[model samples]
Target: MTETSPRPLRVLAAMSGGVDSAVAAARAAEAGHDVTGVHLALSANPQSFRTGARGCCTVEDSRDARRAADVIGIPFYVWDLAERFREDVVEDFVAEYEAGRTPNPCLRCNEKIKFAALLDKALALGFDAVCTGHYAKVVTLPDGSRELHRASDTAKDQSYVLGVLDERQLAHAMFPLGDTLTTKDEIRAEAERRGLAVAKKPDSHDICFIADGDTQGFLAARLGRAEGDIVDEAGNRLGGHDGAYGFTIGQRKGLRIGHPAPDGKPRYVLDISPVDNTVTVGPAEALDVTALTAIRPRWCGRAPEGPGTYTAQLRAHGGETEVTAALEGDELRVAFTEPVRGVAPGQAIVLYDGTRVVGSATIATTTRRDRTTAPTA
Candidate 1:
């Protein structure tokens, strides 16, 4: 349904116990929807996940959500989806890294946990829509189909991470905070006016599961220490690393190489192969890629019938780059208008037609402009 429609809807607000979420739920309720606040318990062992201002899905978060619901005069409940979250988001994260790829767990969480599992349950329980605090818009066309778009506030737009949502999910999704052009400070001010206790709660950052914000440490604990060699582009060993999974494409620091490069330039991580446990480093120029092959494309609406010029966002906070993309037998082949650096396999490649989200896919392989293969030896 259109956001402007006066008809009351049964909206399931997925409150994360943060200021934005609380404000979103309040706005949905104020809009005359039958809103019920629900906080997802993502971890079975609350202590395993982080707490306080820097983390989410903790016991404190649940209490804060409940308090916000109380202030909003709505019913609140906590759903335990720890098993689902672990199997889908957490396990997949480790598996992807083990395969020498970097995965975005937040995108995976929206795809698998929040939209897939939670939305299924919400729909089955007779909810009309599942709402969240994500800064993205759902534009309902006259034809009754929905299109996901970037928020009016470009700085807070979260449509990139939400690119995984398919049409069905988009049809039943609501982002109440999207259309607001106001700054985040205004949202907190609104929250304070509404009497939400989480008005001043700090926004969660980094990988929430990694409580200490130490992703390498967390992966080492899971995959264990497997000492590996860090080599240069020509197959010369530059240094040693505890694990190849600890590095990512385009990473420049903490490589621990003893000697400077021949040109006295800094080296960047160019490749990671879990099979051989090798981290390949090279000059920054070698990292430039012109094309990519992506798999498992999830279209927000219908898949594009032919090659189309679009803008692609490689990382969550990265700027968009122009690209010509085509789909062939489930594989999306994208040619960048200009070479891009820091793109890694398993990262979600989100395509957009201006402000509208077109689709997303997992980057499988990259084609460098030089077409020179890394040294196998």
Candidate 2:
């Protein structure tokens, strides 16, 4: 494996009061870097503590981070980026939903907050690179250009969320957990051996701002009740819903359609239109899409180098399929070898070449294939 750093340098590790980050800071210190642990106060409500694995980014989380920093023998500080997190991540998430899109707030956090905001601050504070416990690898290629790749453990790989980071942000980022053969349990065991406080802390899975995990209720309070018609593709009204903004593409639950399908299968949410206030539901087969268009593409490396074939990953944990990709102005157009399901607009479409992450873009549109397009054998 390539060296994490060429020389001993000052590094800032963003400890999220978790075992992974605690172990990461420990590894960075072991690597002989001048490491300091910093915890981000990202939650708007600072007084609330992580209760029963529900809310993260609480006072408890920050305290745990400081305790771990103490155990790691590093100076610890808390930076209150609550305002920036609210504006960049929380607001953007609500805005995307208001516009009828499924937004990934974790991606936004990595793109605008964790890497951009935190890294910028670290640079001003004289840190060489900002370290985190993200489960993704950064390696220097044969030609010396740095590249980001999936973690050794596919089950825990977080490259999909980290794909939004460009080359510059990645250059100054360190992920010690990415190169490890140690599983999560082993990391926690290391934390226990080291006596870190967050050794058994549960992982934060929900959107940090939405503490209750009721996305529909959370959105309803923000966007208000804008009830609309539920329709099929042919504009036939099937039923009515509380609000179109609350629904998402490829959603099959809580559709509230009274009738059952002729084939005894269930209908799924195929599209959500905020402009017309419509939720379109159809059979499961209607979700298959062959071609997709993405806007505002951001490259992690040199912009694709005249794109030929790239493995396009459609979802965070979704499988990748071979695709024919090309750039069209500032947008990316890709044709999938097979129709993909659950592809929604406003979600990110990350591209990869082998294990190296190429870049990502927000999905703009998708074209479903018709039966007439079938090739004769």
Candidate 3:
């Protein structure tokens, strides 16, 4: 007697017209899954289009995605997600900057627009799972809970930005490029062999919404000119800045201070006070931070109950450091094992355990430890 083959799962592949995502869709097809390709139309401003290595949602990218879908023999559709993208990603970016916070728009795009919105739509259309080109993994535990893990390629690991995904989102997600792939070169090479158009396309860089990789220019265009005084640690005026929104914590360059420090060293931006219209300058050592407090924390699989130690990374591509983390109501208090340099406010602090993502939160404030000498022996 002959046995019947199992039915193929229906998957919606989010193709960004890039080599990785193209290969991801092809791989899903090869796995005997019924796959469809979707390219999200995200950009609203026509002036946002620029021929550079950074822009991803341009007309060229959309055409490339459509061609890749044709090559893979899948039904392709371009969803007009411009309204949602602007509201969730671009608008949120502007609001964060205006409020003196540096926000990661890509992470917000992934969490809100891509996964949440697109995933829900796919499910409503009878798709079993939504797949992406992210270099991360989803695992099913013995207790029937899904867990998110880092990709095999540590250098290309994207778990840091994805740590904000909750358990429900992880369950409905699939990462087709997670387990087998290592370097981007290999993926592009495979795409070339498959005769895909985006095989040699350069990866998108910087913030997608910022057309020319000019955050200052973008902010000035949106928030207008708000000139402010540059001050010292003692609240003495040193010079002037274009805008407080243009500066961030621990920035050294672009500070128009004419004179050097008292010890003949370069002065760095230690603080940006929107209230006083001032940017504080100080020594590099002033950038070191020992503790960080975060608001709106989100755990991946489950939230930690009590004080527990975990490795925390403050920025994307930043080195991880051991930190004692505790849950205080809706906030997360993190005490670094050693002093971490340049812990900026408004950045996301992601906690990890080995290859698994634990949780993440936005840095509300960071406090430095005061060095005090004991009594003389």
The lDDT for every candidate, in the order shown, is 0.91, 0.86, 0.82
Candidate 1 achieves a global lDDT of 0.91
* RMSD (CA, angstroms), candidate 2: 2.1
Instruction: Give the higher-TM-score candidate: 2 or 3.
Output: 2
Flag the better candidate by lDDT, 1 or 2: 1
Clashes of each: 0, 0, 0
In TM-score terms, candidate 3 sits at: 0.94
Local accuracy of candidate 2 as per-residue lDDT tens digits, 219-329 = 999988988999887898888988887899999999888888667888899989888999998887788888999999998888875657889887887988999889989
Candidate 3 residue-wise lDDT, 42-90, digit = tens? 8776347555423277777788889999999999999889999989888
Q: Give the winner by lDDT.
A: 1
Pick the TM-score winner. Answer: 1
Clashing pairs in 3: none
lDDT for each residue of candidate 1 in 18-86, tens digit (9 for 90 to 100): 898899899999999999999999988877778876427888888898999999999999999999999
